[model samples]
Target chain A: MDSIFAIPLISAIVSIAGNLAVFRKASFLIAGVAHSALAGVALAIFLASISIELDYFLVATLFAIFFALLATTFSKFSDIDTGIGVSFALAMAIAVILISLTRGYTAKLWAFLFGELFLMTEKDFLYISIALVAILLIFGFFYDKLIFFLFDPEGAEASGINTRLIDAIVVAIVAIAVVAVIRAVGAILAYSIFVAPSAVAKKFSKSVAQSLIYSFLITLICLILGLIVSSAIPISASAISAFIASIIYLLVAIEKS
Target chain B: MAIEAKDLSYSYGKTIALENLSFKIDDGEIIAILGPNGAGKTTLLKCILGLLRANGEISVLGRDPRKDKKVLNMISYVPQRSSLSIDLPIKVLDVLKMTCKEIDSEILRHLELENKLDLLFRELSGGFQQRVLIARALMKRPKVLLLDEPFNGVDVLSQKRIVEVLERSGATTLVVVHNINPVLHAVHRVMLLNKKLVAFGKANEVFRRENMVKVYGAEIPLVVCEEGVVHPLYGDQHG
Candidate 1:
């Protein structure tokens, strides 16, 4: 198995963790978006690099995003906006510099920049499948509680839900998902898997649970089709997935129209 | 008892928001808590909801408020209008759906908000926002409705309308009202407060010029003529 696939699988899990943790706090929306952007930037850097251990680099970036997100979101790191800007800027700048140093900023960078490659190993495929199952299990267990916390904790608490515990469970799920998908989409585009499906689903959802289910189905379709098209057409799975997602969004819009 | 408190004292970094306060609300009575600015009216409401940690014995719906939150859910809280941000990206009808159990189609129609359900919640006026919260509180079918300053910037017509709804609901209502005249007839009793309970009972008994002076200080010049009707001659700003 090519080591690069391992990175995305782990990344997918960790990214999900980060996204889920912030769903309870006041800045959940901001936290989700910022972490997503950071993940995208990191994956872009990896795509630009050569001779780098794909697993090590992906794990480092995941840790960096998780640590930075938690420190900035949970703690008062000189205010939220300032902390997000500074942390994200530093991480992206460092990753970009490293990528440039390796490749001298040539057109070859586009392969990584725009997701123009699809290389996978047997182990990576297995890991991703297992990670996907784990993600489903975690989500199913905490679905009701997480939905309640996101919408209204006062009501959640009134209904005898341990909001904080439920919030923690969601964080764990997002983290695992982020770790798992890191290779499939990379750091930069990983959140596309986490957020896009949910976002597009929002326009059509009647309830939080429905939106979540819609997002899961949309994600499953993207992963399968993206992997297939990339292997057959010599394109990057990341880019293919994004294109397919956009198509899905368009379909939704057209259907609504 | 529907609600009971004894020696209730709450502190916000030693500021003493509520000081050794004692009060009770019966099973089914509309009580108004009247006080000057900063007189701890809101503090009293929070104390009952257990939102504010207090040093006193408090019970609601036959359970300790600090222990069982389910018992607290039996009570609906209408928080200060100033504390909430309405401009968030949520529809008025959507928020109402989140509040109540069933989201009855007749609720907004009953509150005269049937046409404005699709609008952004933050886009509404202050009166409209309060009404939305009132509708949320009403949806709970709470045994006790604790409203804090619900009528700020409210028009007389809307106030009368709200009073009519509360009067007809038959729930135990505890309201913090600024105006005494309009509520003189609505509430079954009024609690005059000044960091403490100055007096508690029927509005006619507690709305005396002497009690008003005690609660508001000498600054409020109330003209209590020989006929027993009291009129506000000047505004008092004491707490």
Candidate 2:
């Protein structure tokens, strides 16, 4: 419920999930999943307006996971990037339609777009904590196999690693992480946390563990800095955090070049 | 027999990748699968690994690879070195340790990669990368080893080291290569392919001018050395 504790927990989840996304080369895929969550949020709000109760987080998780798997299936017909791109457009289109059908939806939209961390309830924190634990346990247990599959998928499969199960786990992680982070920081800001830290970390990291630690440190810094700066100014913390993340990524890219 | 195929065929939609191809590999024999680009060399290996479902029968170690999930435990694969585009900072030790708990340091020593275990995989030269992959495949002590383009982009010395290791591996190996020259002395038989099994026999018998022309679509010049080994001269491009 407290903004002080919420920032760090969200940062940890985003950093680890973001690092995995970078390794999977699924930044856009994760972004697509986050964007698709808007559809579920809008549908949930629309149902609420009609006197039907539904949890937005629950609906968003389902939507994100569906779109994530759908993108993979579409990849069989085309390249992965194209599949994700198409799925992203479709998700946005559905979101727009759902948004139009809902009345008095601006407050809900604003909450999701810029995040309402200050408005987060005890339930949201519990859900996020559970997600963080699940991510840590699953990724920690399967780190080696995951690395092998990501490094050389064919070789991993031939070596008897259940690659399909790995795929499912990865897809689930990306989808769930995106949905959970979006519910906390909103979709646009969540995208930055899910990608920027990991991208910058990859530039300086010498190994996977180094990359993960660097990513977590960078995300935590941005989140804390955003909170401090937003307190001094009249800006939203989520917006400031996203801006800081992007600026850091730009500086790193420039330095690398 | 270690591997046998009967009327085994596969296609990507209507496009035929392989057709009516059948062959048998003896136990502990090292065979080379040669072809120009898109010759289905990789496809055949995929079939044996059960990575792809094909028409007809393919038996590996007297079991249908497609039906028996356990067959995967007996096989290890080295995909094309150039085909891997990993951005992760995984090390050589990480790769070698993926399949086996205790890596055979002897294999690493043979490949001259024992010291490079700490280096990032992407930091390695093409030759070292190929050697690392081969070493990883060997770590499993697989009954059947499948290597797809194992020597692609490898240095001369690395190539020799790889062949030496493969010869000593003593596994039923199927090495898919663009050209047979690099592994000529090591492999017992050469299976020349171009969308079909053009020739499959002893190197001396299959390395004939007609077979070369039929498969490669050009007359590849061959020179017989003092050891009676036939060497083909031509550029083999990856498809």
Candidate 3:
């Protein structure tokens, strides 16, 4: 039980870091790729693992590396015909069905879906803190390259910008982040923390730099509030944060329109 | 260095798009590529742009366009108007604006589209969309402007306006025009293509009735009756 919990919880920790990335205008595909990989592992454990080992940090590290590799590879083919959107959606669907079929053996499946961030534990929180620092450093270093790609991919490529390499690296981050978030909010909802804040922030900014700045600030606020709300009110941290994010996006959209 | 193509050839699958095409575009000279339907005119431009692969050495501004980003950045391309996505929620000004260090109002005024920046690109007429694209290309301040069938579905007035803009762009402009009359006097050099180099020289010298008959597969009849002399029925059938 602890091992199963370990995989998702550590993933949720990384999810926070990846979610931080969306503030810098990373593509939604990265988040999806990351979530899909975690969902694959969670689905596997739900069906086969009779005993849980949530304390295995090495298992989390291996999953991060594996998911990151998949993400990097997928971004290169993101331009291909229907491979990005179609295949990923189908994979997510298959994961849902497999989890549903295994429902009789493990009611903890639903717990994984909603996440138990309230139980992120002192150790998991420490891991999350370290992951956030790493994410911040990476984001700071590659901020210019990432911003340029989003605005004009063709122009950037024509200018001989190494967009393909940047794209692949972003994928790696997404895969790792999705795994991190899986422990708290599950696979499907992890995307909310990743994409919503940035998308909402874009409604107000004129420049890409401004958009990224606001997106990160918004994400940080949501995380702090989500953690606090879930603690005080006995609700899922992910759900509370997601609800707040959705409302903020709605208000931003409505205010602009 | 002047752009030159020697024994240049290209193909798309089994069908031949260009065969042994050869010509030289002198420095600072505007050359208009003239042809009818299926004339392989675009293939030649694509070769120059390095969008399509070809046999034989083709040099643009002395550098291979395929491997040269500096050339690509220096060369302005006005792709076919229809190739652009119309309903992308992008604004006219948004498309026109680029990595140019400075944004000047004079460029928009010259194109006579100074006031329509915020309008959605899809909402603009076909002519306006073409102008917007031109503005985008001009944003780079390129030395060579390459246009592929830019006048398609455009009005005569817009055609004249576009021609005037390109002339004033202070660049060696190359245009692909299907009809000759609108651009015959406007263009300096003409490269007639029908899967190969039919003719390449001065517009008036190369676009004569004899050359048109040879390349277009139709002879324009001139009938002198009583007190009147009738020229080719459809004006200038070839350019």
Best prediction by lDDT: 2
Candidate 1, residues B77-168, lDDT tens digits: the string is 77776655333335677667554657655656667888878776667877787778788778878898888888988777667767777776
Best by DockQ: 2
lDDT (Cα atoms) of all candidates against the true structure: 0.63, 0.85, 0.63
True contacts kept of each: 0.06, 0.75, 0.06
Off by over 4 Å in 2: B235-239
lDDT of 3 by residue, B1-239 (tens): 56788889888878888899777777667788877788888777777777677888898888997777567777777767654435333466666764454656777887778888877666788888877777777778888778877787877877787777777877877888766555555666888788888888875467567777877888655333343422233544434
**Tens digits of per-residue lDDT for model 1 on A1-257?**
34344434433443344334433332333334334434444454455465444453345435544645553554354654565566555555665665555545444334333433255557556766686677768776776566545655554554446765675555445544554444446555554555656556666555444555566667667766777786788777777776786678777778878
DockQ of each candidate, alpha-carbon based: 0.14, 0.72, 0.12
Q: Roughly what TM-score does model 3 have, to 2 decimal places?
A: 0.62
Total clashing pairs in model 1: 34
Order candidates by DockQ, high to low. Answer: 2, 1, 3
When 1 and 2 are scored with DockQ, the better candidate is 2
Better by DockQ, candidate 3 or 1: 1
Q: What is the DockQ of candidate 2?
A: 0.72
